[model samples]
Structure formats: structure tokens, C-alpha cells
Target: MANLILYKQTDLSDRMTVNRSHQANGGMSLFRTTSWKRSFVSSWLLRLSMFLLLSLPNSEGKAIWTAHLNITFQVGNRIISELGETGVFGNHSPLEKVAGMVVLPEGWNQNACNPMTNFSRPETTESWLALIERGGCTFTHKIKVAAERGANGVIIYNYPGTGNKVFPMSHQGTGNVVAVMIGNLKGMELFHLIQKGVHVTIIIEVGRRHIPWLNHHIMSLFTFMAATVACFFLYCARRPRMPSTATRRRRQIKADIKKAIGELELRVLKEGDKEIDPNGDSCVVCFDIYKPKDTVRILTCKHLFHKACIDPWLLAHRTCPMCKCDILKA
Candidate 1:
């Protein structure tokens, strides 16, 4: 019975791993995702960002900085100007009647490796939105092609490999896509609305998006900087020549050693007395936190809990949970 149960759990875990890899590697989203971790993390990050921004007191009238894109259509025999909120952005801001053009690419239709190549075959750019395929290329190439082919801008479609994403080159340049980046989710929806002759005026306000779970970009930079400086100062006070290259090299070597030890420890998850459950529920070896809802399993003994809880504990005892006997405790 236990064997059957374990086998089922293993199969389920494999499926979960595949699903997670897809989402993590940009195969799905929370609303469209099939797993728990990816959806949970994305939702959590968004919520946390909003919470932090809201928590701050509003001061200097510029409370809560955000990015907004006002889109207006520029269509005419020659060039129709005055899009939705183009001129309204700010007068004397270097934009004339037709400040910029928008590229309406087909969403979920293209890959970065291969893009719509026929966009420049003297094609009539009369579609409400352009249908671009992604493949064998970078965004820059697609945009460049669109520009040379008389396209005001471009929109790249979403694919199974690339995550739902966008990129606006405001501080960069006003080339293809008219200096704006947008995701397929919104663009595709907007295209349908426009095709139906429905006026699609929108104010895309990019709010402060904070990620709390893993250090993505800014968080990673700050964390590493802080950790490095903290270590340097802590060692400085202890060693007279701590600020020297020799001290730094020694510390670096220690870090490498620690990493090797950690790998070995993980590879040998079930060691002797060195392993024990200091945390009642969490994994002792990996220091990974555990939840009560986790699966409980016994290693020979009937005593059971989260597999993670036992695996880490087994790093040392590696024996019957109840008897405290060592079988693989070496």
C-alpha cells in the first residue's frame, strides 16, 4: 500500500515539476497557469508591490510614481495626427501633430527566433493590427524591418517559450513600434475592440511592481551589495588586514568551500548524527521552511510528517523516526 502511495506521489511530483518549469520558463501565467507556485508567486509579488506603495505616506503631490501610456490612432491618407492622448502628454514636449505611430502586432502569433518576414514585401499595412510571428530573431530586427517597410511601429506576439511580456524604448529611441512596449494580453484584446469599430482609448498606468519572493533585479543588486559590504566590515573589525586583497581572497575561498560543502550535504541528504530535526516541521538540512499541509511519510518507522521535514532530518539520524536507530547514519 505504501509503495503504491509513494509511486503515485512520485508521478504527481513529476507532473508538477514539468508544469512549474513551463510557467517559470514562460509557458503560462497565473490566470492561465496550471500550477500553484507560479501563480502564487506572481500574485504575491503584485500584491506586495501595491501594498508597499500604498503604505507610504503621500507627500509632495507626486505620491506613488507610476508609468502611463495614452494610446491614440494615427490614421489618414497621408498621416492623420492627434491620437487618443498624444498631444495631451505635454505641449512643447517635441511632439508635433503625429508625434509617434503604434505597431499592432498579432498576439500569441510570433516567436523571437522567427518573426513576420513578409511585413516588408510592399504589403498593405491596412489591418487594424499587424500579425507578427516570432522566431529566429531579436525584437530589434523585427522593429527595424517594420521601420524600413514603412511601418510606424511593431507588436511581437506571445509564444509558449517567451513569457507574457513587453518592452518600451522611451529613453532609447523612437523607432519601430513608436517607442512603446506592450504585452499580448492587453494588445490582443485592444485589437478586437478596435476591429469592431469600438473606440479603444486607454490610460496604461504602470504602477510600482515589487517582487518579494526571490530577488529578481533591483532587489538582488541591493541584497548582494549589502551582504558584501556587511561581510567586508564585519571581517575588517576582526582582522587587522581584513581590507587587503589577501583577506578578500581568503574570504572568497571560504565562500567556495562553503558552497562545495553545501552541495555535498545536499547530495548526501541522509547522513548520520550530523542530521537531526531542530525545527519540528521544517527541514533541518536544507533550511527549507515547511507547512503543515505538506505530505507526511515514514522512513521505515511509522512516525510521519512532511517528506521535506524528514529528508532534512534524515541528513543525520537517517534512521527510524521513532526508534532513533541509525541505518544509513554514516
Candidate 2:
């Protein structure tokens, strides 16, 4: 989703750091920082917060990454669905933005399904993890079948003659679901491993070049750095503007909100729930749009919400909408 000044690959190497070399050539550091390290807890908390921030679902073009393989520039339907930038290879590809790489169901053959069907299994899917063929049908048809079968995840394979990085994916034609593609040359092996019950690992990597938030958080550290330099100058001249009481109060309020929001989001993401947590997690029972004084109910999922808001939602679905935690489960 980046409108980057694409620096095409002139030479690919693992021995050198791109950021450092670029700094040596271009005079500014896009990938390097000189800030002093914080404490261990602070560093982990910062990283964890960053990872969570980038992991949230994003609209197309909002989630940006590098052009690792000179792939087609997609506008409406140029790039078929990639599980985000993390699914591909290369140092510039980041893991933070990816939903997860997908492995298509093995043994489902496309040519076998032709001629009005010699297919044994009914074309209907029974699991959320769907199996789809590569040929004869449009990718949209494959996704539709999988989704109709209750799948939130879709895996599309390359047809027999499908070439790597050739066919483009168009999202304008399908439902909103996380889908990943596997070319015949690369994905065939992983397809077989899945057949052996090997748990598929959805590898998401956020390389230094791929993180956009580094620009924002780096400002906080840099401001702190600027303040330190100002203090040094103040000591030399013995004159400095004191921080106003209002400024301090505003900072305190902002910090309180950030701390609350970050901790609450972390809990919600980790526990996989959305209802109000009566266990001192929040004021409301999950996010049932509780009123100021509405009575709320808490679930074992540690989520709380307005009793009024959840009665109907739970009637049809017992899981929290935010985290997918089962609210009805004990």
C-alpha cells in the first residue's frame, strides 16, 4: 500500500545491511537509529505494542510494504490477494502487516473435477479450513465455495499451467476473507506437509524497512533527545523555559489514556474476547455499547457488555465480535 520511491534490485545480497549501505550512499538513515536503549520491560512493551498496532486489519493501500519481486503494480485488480506483505520473501517484506500465510488443501485436483464431475466428495466444504482446486473455475468461485462452507480463511492454488507471479488477484470480485496464493513451484511442498498433519506456521516478519510506526515513535524518542540537548544548552547559558502546569497536566491525561487503551487492547487481543470483563478489566461488559449506567453481564471469556446489547447478539452468536472468544463457553 506504499507510495514508495521504488528502489529496484540492482544487486541482492545477504552480507550487507541495506539501511547502512543506503546511509553510506544517500546521507540519511531510513533504517538506522542513534537513540539510547530503554529498559528491557520498556523495549518489550514497545515492540509488543507495535506488533499489535500493525496487526489490526487494514484497508488496501493503507497497509504498505516494499516491492520485493518486481511484482505488478496493482490498482483495482493488479495484485490479487496476498495475505499482506509478510507472506512473501525478502528483507524488505515485513511480518507485522501480514494476517498469515495460507496453505491450500492438498489432494483436491482441478482437472479431476471437469467433464461434469468424477469428484467423489460433494463440492460442498465442511470445514472453515477449505480445500479448493486451481483450474477451470475462477478464483472467485473457489473463494465463494469455501466461504459458503463457513470459512473465514481461504487458500487458492495455482492451476497446472499457472506460472509463478503471473496471474493477478482481484478483490473487487469476492467476499472479504484472508486469502493466500501458492504457486506450483513453491507451494507444492508445503501442500504435501499439510497432508502429513504438520502444523502450518504462518510466518509474519516485520523488517526494519517495512515498519511505518518507527517514524512516529521515533519522534517521541527524538523529542526526548531534543529536550536533553536543550537542557545542556540551558546549563551553559543558565536560562530555559519552564514546563507550564497546563502542559504537564495535558501530558498526564494523555499518558493515562494511552496506558488504559494499550493494556485493554492487549487483554482483548490475548484473551480473544470483546464482552465486558467483570474481572476489573473494564467498566463495561464486552463492547455491547453499554450506556453510562446500564447493567452489564460478564462472561467466562472475561468480556463484559450491556446486558441489553448482548442478549440478541448472543442469541445468534455466543462469541465476542472483537476477539472471537466464546462467550457461552465455561
Candidate 3:
């Protein structure tokens, strides 16, 4: 009898050990799955960051430098002087300082598009700068016309209605020629002064450097990326904690079922026992006839089953297979 009890105890011990091992393996699998997902997302985000960085314009090129203009003219026996960083030089223009008396084209059209265009100034005037409008041809054509006529510098104004907005001109191949662009308003002011026969002179100087493309575009890209990362982390933080909690609950329920099964009555059937008699009812779970020395589990309803068949059935269904009696409540 002692040996039989020890054997049953050993069987329960083995089942508990197997259950713990299965739970441990399940936990490890869950950890591996979560880690792989996190790594994939991190790598994808890193690649997206690199692509954005590569798509930006090159920052190593020379910065666009502004030009400061200082204008001086005589107005009704008074000398007026104005100065501001209101001009931008041509892409190919020299950065060196230049000063000269301002002059205009000889006709109603001030664009200076005609190669034969001339400046109505005294031939003896040593250094002169041409003041031309924006449209009517390419900037190179107008600048070349002025440069060909021995003008020391060329100043092209922006289109009308542009207010004070100005941008650098791209007039390549105009070698060693000093060129600058001023806003329509500022250019019109200079044009009127020179047209009214008021002697006007301007000194052009280099101003501060700027990187407008880098400042505007790169900052926008950075803001978008930062917002995307913040949202991803917020989603991760708010997700429900499901894996550990569900696994722990299942383990606790399995332990309670195992303990309840152990508390139920157990019996060993022997010869002449009514349970082992030839006409006695067989174990309903397995539909097998009980013989001598058979281990049977007796439920509260007086129904019996082979221990091997009923143990797992009770664990899963929590009720006797024959009478539907609950072992834990009994």
C-alpha cells in the first residue's frame, strides 16, 4: 500500500515538473518574438532617417552672400545717403567692392537687351554703372551689353510689384564682371534719381552669408522625423500588458485544478470487488472494463473512471465525464 501511494505521488510530481517546463518555454518564446519585432522596427526607422539625410541638398557648397549698397546723391542742395543690405550678387559676379556713377540706357526701354544699347553719359566719365530693368531677355544678355560697353558694374532690378524681394542671378560666363541685383523698389529709386539728372553714386560691399535652403528645408524634415518617433514610442507605452498576465493566470488555474483532483477519493479495484465484477459498469471515460488491481478515481456522484483517463479529463473539463459532477465544488 505504501509503494502504491508513493507511485501516485511520483506521477503527480512528474506532471507538475512538465507543466512548469512548458510554461518556461512559452515565456522564452514570447520574449524572443517581442525582441525580433522591436529590432525590425528600429532598423527600419534607422534606414528611413538615413534616406532623409541623403536626400538633402549638399551643404558644402559656397553660401549665398548678400551685397550691401550705399547710395549717395544730391537733392536740392542737400546730400542724401542711404545704406542697406538690399542687393544680391550674381552667381558668377566678383565679390570685390566697386563704386561708380550710375547711368541709364539711352532709349525708353531700360532693359538694355539690345547689344547696340548705349549709355547717355559724357564720354570722359571714368567709371560708370548701368541701371537696367529685370525683363526683356536673359540677365546674361543685358549684363553682357553693359559689360561690352565698358561699364564698371551692372545692377539689374527685380520685376515690378515684387516689393523688396530679390534673389541672386545665374549669369555664368560673365568673367571678372561685377554684377548685382536690387529689389524693384530700390532699383526704381536709383533709376529715377539718375534719370532726373541728379548725380548718383553707389558703393557696393559684401554682406553677411546665408544658407536659406538649408535653414528652411532641413529644419522641416527634422521636425517631421522627431514627431514620428515620439508617436511610435507613445503607442508602445500605451499598449496593454497581456503576455505575462495571461500566462500567470493560466498557471494559477492549472495549479488549483491539480490540487482539487488530488483531494478526490482514489481506490484500487481487486478480485470479487463489485467495481471489478464481470457485470459491473466499466470506466465510462475509456469504455474499458475494470479488472483486478486497477486504479480508479471515484467522484461525489459514486461514478468511477480509470485514473489515467479521468485525471486529464477533469483537468480540462473540470467535471466528471459520466455524471457531469464538478470535482472542485464537491
Candidate 4:
């Protein structure tokens, strides 16, 4: 009775070990399956997000809200287009046309270190306009000095080396009524005109212009996408097989040529029929006149040639040698 109880206990322990092993294996398999599915979903979502971000344009980065200057001056009763360069709108000014008399600084000494800085003042009887030259100081320093002198508007001209290109100006602590930068060439033109007692006026207006770098990149991306789409549609719509009309026409042409060759009249030429002229009436293929007793073929176009001479020509070209008329077409 003791041996029987021990055997039964050992058997029950073995079955429980086997059941635990099977359960562990099944659990591991389920975990692996779930992990794989989660990984795949995460990868797909990442790719989709990247695609959307690239396809859409960021409005803040690409398009900026700014204003432009439309400067015009009078030249002897004629309001010509004196607007040489448009200035980027400056800070601290309402987007309206600020018209003022153009005035150059005393001694034209616009250097920031110069003690005699002349700027327009509101308290003055006339509107004071300050014209300054670029360089010798930061734009901020120049504008700040001019503002201290109570200038209504400040115009900075480019240095000698700087080309006729207007760029956006940024200055710190410059209380601008209206601020603008003109190209060296345009600035000199206006300066000499003012010196000659010619009155000039500038108009600042709110306008839109291209933003740097961002606009270019966006346009390039759009162009690339457009080209890619065009190519894809062309490939999808392309014909894989030869055109039916062209194939059918080629077959008909070949068949007609063969039938015409079969129905052609072949005869042996006698001495009387061999009265041929070498210069004017000669076989264009062999460039020889017809010989007596020679076997010849006459085309429907009335052109005659030796059988051997015309056979190869007709087989290759399917046309009359002299007239170039298509025997198949006829």
C-alpha cells in the first residue's frame, strides 16, 4: 500500500511539470506576436507623419507679413518713375505714404562716430529729412543717432562696393518715422539731384514681396512633385502595344506589293522593242539600255526594266525607280 501511494504522487508531479512547460511556451509565442504587430504599427505611423510634414507647407516659415517702399520723385513737371529700389518696410511706422522733402545731412557726414549728426525734427518749421551713407557703423547705431536728433525719416544709401541691390535693414533702438535704404547708384542720383536744387519726395506703402530662402525651397519642392506626377501619368497612360492602324497599314502594303509582283507582265523583248536611249530612257537601276531578246517587265506606270533588275528593286522599295510612285498604292 505504501509503494502504490508513492508511484501515484510521482505521476501527478510529472503531469504538473509538463503542463507548466506547455503554458510557458504558449505565452512566449503570444508575446512575440503582439510585439511584432506593435512594432509594425509604430513604423507605419512614423512614415506617415514624415510624409505629411514634408508635403505640407509651413505658413509661418515660408510667408512673412511685411511692407515695401514705393519711392517716386519729380523731375521738371514730369512725375517719372524715379523709384529705383524698393525698401523693405521698417518697424515703428504706420503703413501709409510718408511724403517729405529730401534733405542731406550737414557736410554729408553720416558716420555714426561723427559728432555733428543732422536729423529732421518735428518742432522745426519744415519737415527735417536725414540722408545718411552706409558703413562706419551698424545700421542700428546710425538710425539711433538720427532718431536722437529727431529725424522724421531716415534714408541710408549703399556703400561704393555694395551693388544696386536693396536689402532688408534691421536696427536696434531706432525710433523710425520712416526708414529706407537705397542702392548706391540710385542714392547718388537722388543726392546729385537734390544738390542741384531739385526737390524729391518718397512714398512708403504696404506691399508684398518674395521671402528669402523659404519661397525658393517651396517652389523647388512643388516643381519636383509636379514633374514626378507628370512622369507617372505619362508612364501609366503609355501604350504597350504597337498602334493597330500602323500595323494594319504595314500588312496591307506588304500584301499589295506581293500581289502586284505576281500579276506583273513578263515578256521577252525583240530587236524592234529594244530601241532604247541610254541618256534619256535607261533602266535607272542598272543604268543600261534594254538589249534584244532580254526578258523584261513593264510596270503599271509604263516604266520598263529587265526582269532581274526590277525584281530586286520592287521587292526592296515597292515603288517605281524613275517616278517613285508606290506600286502597292496604285
Candidate 5:
């Protein structure tokens, strides 16, 4: 019996140990699953937020319309004006109207590859402009050099690779001057005109061009807002009616206004009336003196005006014109 009792006690101890181990393992597994779920949810939320932020319209750095370049010259007996491709305006550049005679560097008149590092001023000595090709330095550098030499504006033609496609430019820190770029083809055309001794005048004018993506987003937002407003109105129309306090107050106010208007006193202006001096009192609407035998209406606030004038004014304004007293409140 003593051996059997010892055996039974050992068996009970082993069973309790196994049970405790299984419970601990189950708790650890549950904790690991919870941790993974939390991590996954947090990562998903972060990614969603980033996507939303990037998807919104960029209010800063809005795209602007490009300026137009108008080039004019005399072809034999007739005058010719051709529009050239325009590029971006420089930052802090003046948008005011700039008109001047086009000039090229002394040795660079016929050469498209002219670096224009040393440009010659025009012989006329009036407000003249510089024509340079895009190469050898930054846009700001070329513009700044030309501006220092007293050029009213600087026109840079695109490189050969850009063909006839004009693009906007950023020349920050450059002096206040009008700077524009043209396509390679337009530049060559103007260059040849100058080479042929044809005097050309170019005009830079500010113009508007719509950005495709911005217009699309604006239309989409407008449509969405209109639909939302329409849906809200529809919901209100379909919603069950309840007499709220505001609605009841508005109705009471309307009724009071009608009652006040019905009880308003009417009088006729005469020469000897003590209430009104026809010569002194003028109709505010017509700015005319009140005449004898004229009919008028008196408001609750004791302000008087011609019936034809005050009736229409009260119907529209719902208050005394001079005193601004509310008939509904009275």
C-alpha cells in the first residue's frame, strides 16, 4: 500500500506539470498573434496616409501660363509679324510690357553657336535687346550678363535637341529683367533675319495657358461638391418632417411681419400738415421734395416715406430704410 500511494502521488505531479506547460505555450502563441496583427494594422495605416497625402493637389508651386513672343519685321514693301515660341519667365522677372529692337553680338550675328560672352550694344543706343543661344552657361548667368550690359531683355533660344519645343525657365537671383526662351527653329529664323540686315522688333506679352492636370482636378472637385450638395438636399427632402424650434420661429416672424405691414398707418401730405413739411422732407428714393396731396405710409418706428417708394422697399428689405427697424420684431 505504501508503494502504491507513492506511485499515485508521482503521477499526479507529472499531470499538473504538463497542464501548466500547455497553458503557458497557449498564452505565448496568443500574444504573438496579437502582436503581429497590431504591427500589420499600423503599417497599413501608415501607407494609406502617405498615399492620401501624395494624391492631393499641390497648392504650392502652381503651374502658370507661358508668355507669348511676337516678332515683327519688314519684308520688302510689306510688314511681317510672326509669333515665336515662348519659354518660362525668370523668377522675380518683371511682367510689364517689354518692346525693343533685337540685336546679336558683333562676331556672332551669323553663327548659331555664338557663346555671346561679350555682346555689343546696339549702335542706336536706345533700349536694345540681346539674342543668345542656349549653351556655355546657366540661364541666370547669361541673363545677368546681358542685363549688366544694359540689355532691356534677354532671349535665349533652345539647343538643337529641343527642336521647336519651348519650356519655362527658372533664373532666380538674376536681376529684374524680362527673360524668355524660344525653340531652335524660331531662333534660327530670327537669327537669319538679323544676318540679312533685316531690322526685327520682338514683343513679350503675358498670356494665359491652362494646365491639364490642374483643370481636371478642379473640375472633378467642383463636380464632387455639387453632387454632395445635391445629395444632401435630396436627403433633407426625403427626411421625416419635424417642427424644429428654428422653423417655428421663422414662421412666427413671417406672420408678425405680415401683421405689422397690414396695420401700418397711411396718410396724405398736405401744405399745412404738422407732421410733415413738404418743402423740408424729401423722398429718399427719388431725392425729390414731397409735394402737397402726395400719399405716404408711416412705419411703426414713425419714419415716413411715399407709399409707392416705401411699399416696394419694405417688401424687399423688410425694414425701415432710415432707422433699419425690423417690422417683424416690432
Candidate 6:
């Protein structure tokens, strides 16, 4: 009876300890979850800020603008015409449509590097466009020289050996001037025709517009969002699994059985003890008679058995060997 009371007290103590441990673990889990949420929010905000910064317009404060050029030249008795969006406007050029006869500088050098470069204009042609080579001076200086020479518009070609490559030129302080750049190959074709004194006329009109930096911003934002979503799913998939209700109950029962086993009374058989008698019932586990100095255990049902044998038996069965009494209920 005393052993039964001690077993019950031990079981109850174990139950309280498990409950306190669970509560403490729950509190710590809540704190860690809260901290993780805060960190996730902060990380998202930082990514959003970077995305916004990347989405901003280019620092040059201007987007690339393309120009469509229509050219008509008289070859023999037939007039040849061609049209394509093969030109980019200068950064400071005015967005306007202009048309005129194409002309070159007065001297052998096609680049209007000299501030006093003169344009040979036909007496009958009221408006003419200056065709200049790109080199030897700043774009601003060339455009200014052409504009001051009574040219209606300016068209600068790219460097030699560069076939159809063109970019928007940075020509500040040349206000309201209609300046455009063509590829070196295209420029050479026109230059030869104009040099041969073939009458060439061109019509320049605004074409498509493009923002080069916008694509990078969009791709970066998509990558960041994808990574964040993948991380969230990975975390959820790897989180620790909680114990089921049935599993918890099974664990608690095992703990109770161990505690009861530890609380059972142990005794040593002596020479005069009845347990040492030859006529006494043998241990059900080992089928052996108890002898002097043999260790035995007393169960709550008043049944006895060898301590070594009953300890393993109670752990598996949790009951007395003879009467089948449950130690936990006793």
C-alpha cells in the first residue's frame, strides 16, 4: 500500500513537470514566431525600397527617341526613294518634323569642326539640312555651327566602320535645334550621292520611344518576389511537426509505468524467509525458486517476484505477475 501511494505521487509529479515544460516551450515558440514575422516584414520592406529605387527613371533625365528618315534621290532620269527608322535624336533636340534638301560643308572636310564652316545653299532652295560627320569636336559645337549657318536641321553620322549603330547624343545648350544621328553606313551612302551632286532630299519625323532601364527594374522585382515566396514555402515545409493527441497519451502512459516500476518495494530473501522455502511458488518469469540473499520485489497485490525479473516485466506489462493487478490503478 505504501508503495502504491508513492507510485501515484510520482506519476502526478511527472504529469506536472510535463505540463510546466510544455507551457514554457509554448511561450518560447510564440516569442520566436513573433520575432520571425517582424524580421520577414522588415526584409520585405527593404526589398520594396530597392525595387522602387531601381524602377526610377535613368539619371540622364531623358529617354531614347528614334527618328524615321525618308530619303529621295534622283539617279539618272529616275528618282529612288527609301524609308526606315534608322536614326536617333540628340538629347537636346526638339521633337519636330523637318524636311529639306541635303547639303554638305563648303570644304573637303565633311565635319563642321570649324565655327565658321560654311554651307553651300542653292539660290532657289529656301530650306536645307546640313549633313556633318561625327568627330573632331563636341556635338554641341557642330550643331551650333550648322544652326548658325542658316540650316533648317542637322544630321550627324556615327564614326567610321560602325555599320548601323546609333545612340542619342548629349548636346546641351543647342536649344530648339532639330538634330539627328544616322549609322555610318547610311551616312556614307548619302554623302557619296551628295558629293556626286545628285539632288537628295530627306524628311525627318519622330519615331518610337524607349526607356532602357525599365526592363532591369521589372526583372529584378520579379526575382526578389520569387525568392521570398520560395523561402516562405521552404520554412513552412521544414517546421517541426507537433505530437498527436494519441501519441502524447501513449508517452504519458509509458512515463507512468516507469515511475511505478521505480517505486515498487525491493527486499532481500534471507535463510528463514518463506520465499526461500523449497515448497514456495517459483518466479513466473524465470521459473526459479527464491534462495537466501536473492533480491525480490513486492507488488501492490501482495504478490512477489525476483526484482530483476519483475522490473523488465512491469515495464512491458505494467501488472503484477500472479494476480494480474495493474500497478498504476493500485
Q: List TM-scores for all candidates, in order.
A: 0.28, 0.28, 0.56, 0.42, 0.45, 0.53
Which portions of model 3 miss their true places by more than 4 Å?
1-60, 212-221, 233-330
lDDT of 6 by residue, 1-330 (tens): 122223334543555465456545543443454556455545554544544453453334457788999999999999899999979888899999999999999887999999989998788998889999999999999999999988889999989976767878889999887999988899999999998999999999999886544544555568678877876775676454655578889899999999998888889989998778788889999999998999999998888899999998998999887888999999
lDDT of 4: 0.61
- Give the alpha-carbon lDDT of every model: 0.40, 0.41, 0.78, 0.61, 0.67, 0.81
How are the candidates ranked when ordered by lDDT, highest leading? 6, 3, 5, 4, 2, 1
Per-model root-mean-square deviation over C-alphas: 26.7, 33.7, 22.4, 27.1, 30.6, 20.2
Best model per TM-score: 3
* Ten contiguous residues minimizing lDDT sum, candidate 1: 85-94
In candidate 1, stretches whose alpha carbon ends up further than 4 angstroms from where it belongs are 1-67, 72-136, 157-164, 167-179, 194-330
Tens digit of per-residue lDDT, candidate 4, span 209-293: 4453464356546755765576566545554443457888987877878789878888887765544444446677887877777
Q: Pick the candidate with the highest lDDT.
A: 6
Q: Candidate 2 versus the native: TM-score?
A: 0.28
Model 5: per-residue Cα lDDT over 1-330, one tens digit each: 122223334543555465456545553444454655444444433433333343344323445446678888998999998773355454456665687898876663322243344555456768777888887667787787777777899888877755666655677886678887667787888888887988888888876643534653564466556655765665576444656678889788667666777789989988777645545767787677777798888888988888888877776678998889987777
For candidate 2, the clash count comes to 19
Span of ten consecutive residues with least summed lDDT in model 2: 6-15
Query: Which TM-score value belongs to model 5?
Result: 0.45
Q: lDDT tens string, model 2, 79-132?
A: 432333312222221223232223343344642233233212234423233434
For TM-score, candidate 1 versus 6, the one ahead is 6
By the lDDT metric, which is better: model 1 or model 4?
4
